[model samples]
Target: MDSAVITDTKTSMKAIFSDFKQLTKVGLSLSVVFSSVAGYLLAIDVINYFTLFLLALGGFFMVGASNAFNQIIEKDTDAIMKRTQNRPLPTSRMSVKIALTIAILFTVSGIAILYSINPKTALFGAISIFLYTSVYTPLKSVTPLAVFVGAIPGAIPFMLGWVAATNQFGIEAGFLFMIQFFWQFPHFWAIGWLQYEEYKKAGFNMLPMNTKDKGAVKQIIFYTVIMILVSIVPVLKLSGAFYIHPITAIIVALLGIYMLYFGVKLHRSEENKDARKLMLSSILYITLVPIIYVVDKFLH
Candidate 1:
């Protein structure tokens, strides 16, 4: 084969891989998989590597499917938004039919993989995809409550692990769900506030007030308080099998307070930089809280 042809092939392959990465929102999806595995680790006492692998793989594909569907649904709007304009679908690097096929394949494979663990896991997997694609995607254009609706699916990955482990959706699982559910509001609102200009070019209204103003900041603070309160609930041992150590809860509380401090800064200054700080803090808080829970359980 000609060297020129060989180089072209390699470049094409790299382009294809990069496009798929963007289409799947690989970095974001991996964090979601982490959330699921963290829940699985929290729920299971003994290590089951096979089940763990399946949970992580299924969770990734589930998130991948949702992202693909989201891009496909909002290709036009996403194209208009600076944050999403370069995505494969919006950039026309990949055709809609191809993206849809990938989404369908992911959905089917993800659910099947989860089903191997148990029926309930598969059910939750399907439900998350359906809610994300069917409901939340459409709601984004209509109302700010879309954020509230989207939170339902966003919250599930953590609790999905417990269901995967025990095949039961109990108070323990519900507790995990609530923590992530409230967390979503502030996390997403911060993003919305920061991207308010870009979002104005699109057709979405994720912010409660659709503006970076006092009302929006207040809503973010309210949800931040609720999220912090929920994070401390595991100390109550609301679930017989899933409580965190008191010390860990203390750590989690302090992390929440750290995040809220940024929220307060944003409230006081009403600065875009403050919103960015709050967003970073929220990410840090969510990432650490789960680790604290899983680590605290193992250490003590």
Candidate 2:
């Protein structure tokens, strides 16, 4: 092989890799997969490695497809936002044809993998993609309620794993869903707070009150309170299969308080720095709480 041919091949491979990463939003997809896996772990006494792999792969494909479609739909707005200007679609690093192809492939592949696990898991996975791309993506430019719409798909993952494991829906699954559902409010609101100006400039209605003021901060704090309360509810149930140990409850509550402290600071100070801190804490809170659930289960 000629040196120039080898160099060209390497460059083409790098571009392809970069496009795949950007299109899938790899880090975010992995985090979503982690939540699904955590839910699966919590719901099952024995681990099936093949089922676990299928869950992670199918979950990633579903999330990646949604992100791809979102990027394609919002390519125009994304091109305008500082945070998204350099993405594959915006920079012309990837053609719409290629992006669309990847999206369709992921969608099909994801559904098939999940269908192998259970029909319920596949149904919820399909619902997630539809709601995210068809409903949530377009709503971002039209209403602040887009966040609420987006949360529906967002909340599905944690409960999704439960359904995949047990192939049935119950209060335990609903509990997991509610926990993630409420958690998104504070998580995404902090993001809205941090990116208000950019999102506004891009014609995206992310903030609840459409302004970065007392209204938005108040709502953030309100949701944070609800989120914390929801996180502790498992402990209140004395007769459930999903109740966590009291010690784990204390740990989760402490994490919630850590997140809430930043929420309050963001409210009082009205500082972007605190909003950023709140965002980080929310990430930490979500990440740890699920692991704590699994650990508390084993130790119970």
Candidate 3:
């Protein structure tokens, strides 16, 4: 190719990669990936390095694809919201056609890699992507219940990795899914409370639309309490597989209390700043729990 042609090709490649990055919501998606990998490691009896790597890779792309489709479907609403207005789709950095094409390609590739590991994993991944993009994305503007709908698919990755490793769904996978499912309420509600105005502007009714009088905050505290209790379920069982020793149980309990402290403070304060703080605390709790899970597994 001529020099100008080569330069143009390189520029095009760069633009495409940048758009793809936005599609993936790379940072957020990768964090989901970390928890999935942690789940796989914690659940697996025998560690196959290659299988683990593929599981993470497949899980990451599946989540990335889900996010891409979500962005595409919400592009119009996203343009109206300040938080999402600059995203590739909203900014016209990429066309919806291109975004959809990438979404389909990535979703297929992700599911294929997962299928190589196990059929059940591939099936669950397909369902996650479908529920997130098709169901949750469109529901955002329609009702506050979108948060609950979104959580179902959001919680899949952690359990997904477990299914990939064990090729079965049982109590272990159920616990992983439940912890993440319950955690989402406090995590996203705090975010919803903090960004209620922005979300309102975009026609989204987050934070229990009508009741401003501590309903959302009370719900956050309620869920946080449940999350704390769920975190310790494995400790009572003596099977070294999921059981935590007394010391590790204390560590997990303290972590839960720390999160609970923030949840209660936000409940009482009901201030936007406190809501944001609680949101950050929720993120910290979720991210750290996987580490706690892995550590306690080894410690015991």
Candidate 4:
């Protein structure tokens, strides 16, 4: 082949890969996978490497598929938002036909992988995608209550791993789900606060009260407190089969307190800087708390 043609082909391939990454939202999907892996580590007495690998793969693909459909549904709104305007669908970097094909493949493959683990895990995976794409995606522009609905699918991966491990839903799984469920409030509100203008441009009512006011900030602080309270419940022996060691519980409490500090700061200052700090601290709290729980479980 001609040298020019070869160079052009390579460039095209690179662009395609980059668009694929945007379509999949790799960073967010990987965080979901990490949570799923942590849940698996917590549930199983003896870790099965292959099963963990499958859980990660299935979780990533399922999340990617849900995100792809969301982008497809909201392509126009995404084009209006500064944060998402450059996404593949919004920018015409990828065609709807191609994006749909990718999403279908991801959905099918993800379900199949999870089904290999157990049918219930696959069922939850499908349910998450449906709820996210069909319900949460469309509801974003309709009402702020969408955040409450969106939390269901958002909190699934952690518990999905437990289902994959034990093939049952019980108090332990419920505890995992509730922790993430409460955590999303503060985490998402902080983002809603920081990106209030951009989200407003897209007509998304993500923040409580649909405005960055004292009421919204107060809700953030309230949810942050609730999240901290829930994080310590396992240590108090309130949650069945979900106990954390005393030392680990203290560490988790300190992490939660750090997140609470940012939430309180955001409330008092009403500044985007504080909101952004709360957002970062929320991420750290969720990530570290899970790891600490797994480590503490293993050691005890």
- lDDT for every model? 0.91, 0.93, 0.84, 0.93
lDDT of 3 by residue, 127-179 (tens): 99999988888888888888889999999989888888889988888888888
Tens-digit lDDT track of model 2 for 1-300: 899999999999998998899999999999999999999999999999999999999999999999999999999999988999999999999999999999999999999999999999999999999999999999998999999999999999999999999998899899899889989988999999999889989988898968888789888888888887888888988425788878888999999999889988998998899999999999999999999999998887
The clash number for model 4 is 0
Residue pairs clashing in model 2 are: none
Q: Which portions of model 3 miss their true places by more than 4 Å?
A: 1-15, 209-211, 238-240
Report model 3's TM-score to 2 decimal places.
0.93
lDDT of 4 by residue, 1-300 (tens): 999999999999999998999998999999999999998888999999999999999999999999999989999999998889999998898999999999999999999999999999999999999999999999999999999999999999999999999999899999999999999999999999999999998889999989898899899889888888888889888888879878887898899899989988887899999999999999999889889999899988
TM-score of each: 0.98, 0.98, 0.93, 0.98
The regions of model 4 sitting more than 4 angstroms off are none
Give the Cα error of residue 25 in candidate 3, in Å.
Answer: 0.6
Q: Please give the lDDT score for candidate 4.
A: 0.93
The list of candidate 1 runs beyond 4 A from truth reads none
Clashing residue pairs, backbone N/CA/C < 3 A, model 1? none
Q: Roughly what TM-score does model 4 have, to 2 decimal places?
A: 0.98
Task: Supply every candidate's count of residue pairs whose N, Cα or C atoms clash at under 3 angstroms.
Answer: 0, 0, 0, 0
Error of 1 at 130 (Å): 0.6
